[model samples]
Target: MSLREACESGKFVVTAEVAPGKGTDVEHLLKDAAIIKDRVDAINVTDLQSSVMRLGSMAFCHLLTDMGIDPVFQVTCRDRNCLALQSDLLSAWALGIRNVLALTGDHPKLGDHPTARPVFELDSVTLLDVIGKLNSGVDMVGNELKGAPDLFPGAVVNPGADNEAAMDLQIMKMEKKIEAGAKFFQTQGVYDLDAFEKFMKRIEGFKAKVFGGIILLKSVGMARFMNKNVAGVFVPEPLIQEIKDAEDKVQASMNIAVRLVKGMKDLCDGVHMMTLGWESKIPGILDEVGL
Candidate 1:
């Protein structure tokens, strides 16, 4: 089934992240995608993930679509103006890309180009609204369009916020995104299932499909870095220690991911596995979780 159909059908959906290369060398990227293409309902091509410059997501997503794989084109609002953003969306539709994930990406200072200026012409919430406009045969400024893109749009939410106020704000933003025409939501990386259960409780009665984000922890250092630097993501001490004490860190990471996926399967409509550089591990993780 298509990702949109899978979400609306209330099935236990699964998607994985595919990061583009720093250059035009897409041969490796396509090869990696082929590994998990059949294993996932759709693959999300990240837009310069981590604010680092790379191949554009739209180009890579088109490649994935040409390869007969459903591509969820992730559009971040950090690098493009409203015109460029809208133009990209229309182009994506013309190229047969149906799924999109809107995001207010990381600042450029946090990436390879520390001296580069970042553009925040529109945030994710506003971008979601723009998608609705395009779907309704209009532009952001209410201009009529000759054709409209029938997009199954989604927005990101952070269920793993560090504090109560932050969590509440995340829920409020979720409400805005849904009102702005978000068909589904993909959350930030979640480790605390009990906390996520509470988050679900607060968002009860909402209609959007929720997908819990799961990032595999490769080592104690990685876990610590995310905990300290990554907003809305906290690696519980026990999980960090699990990696620290493991004889085989890779296997330990896979086991932890499987545990998180199994725990979230019942509460969420889907789980988005983000393995970063370990894309090949996704198929194995899915097999272990029986997804």
Candidate 2:
């Protein structure tokens, strides 16, 4: 069954992501995906992740579909205008991809190509709105279409916001995205389970299906980097110290991920894994967590 069907059936879903490289060879991406294909409900294809130029998300999603895997085709508004965005959605549907994750991508300045122009023609909310329109047998302007896409659209969320005000804004955006037709959400990496639990409790009324995000803590440095640079992601110092003190760092990282997954058992609809480059270790994490 597709990821949408899995979630609708009240199954606690599991999802992961795979990013395309700047160059043409996809052998590595495919091999990694094939390793964890059966373990994940769906695999998200990143769109020029971090705003760095890379192989197309749509193309890789198509490849996943051809390989009999369900792919969450990520569409970032930072690279495409509305016209192009709608066009690409239809193209993706024609290519047999159903799941989509809408994102307002990072700025090009944060990427390898700082001089490239950025396009914020539509943010995540607006993009979700456009997807709704497409599903309803029309384009963004209310024009009729010969064929409309039956896309299972999802969006991102940041549960570990820095402050109360930021958390409030995140909730507001989550509601707005729901109104705009977001059926599910995959949040940013979270470490503090108590804070994440509090955030989940506040949104209990929405009845939304949220997949709590998990990033394997590779090292103390990685945890610190995410905390200092990434917005809405806070890695508590205790967890950092645990990584720093570990003699077997890889096993320690897997154990940390296992704990995070176990913590979300009663809170979220599922968990979304963003393992960075540690994709092959997912099975071990899942097995350890008894998922």
Which candidate leads the pack in lDDT?
2
lDDT per residue as tens, model 1, 40-115: 8899999998889999999999999999888999999998999999999999999989999999899999899988
Each model's TM-score? 0.97, 0.98
Clashing pairs in 1: none
The Cα RMSD of model 2 versus the native structure comes to 0.9
Model 2 lDDT tens row, 177-251: 999999999999988899889889888877568999998888888888888899988888888888889899998
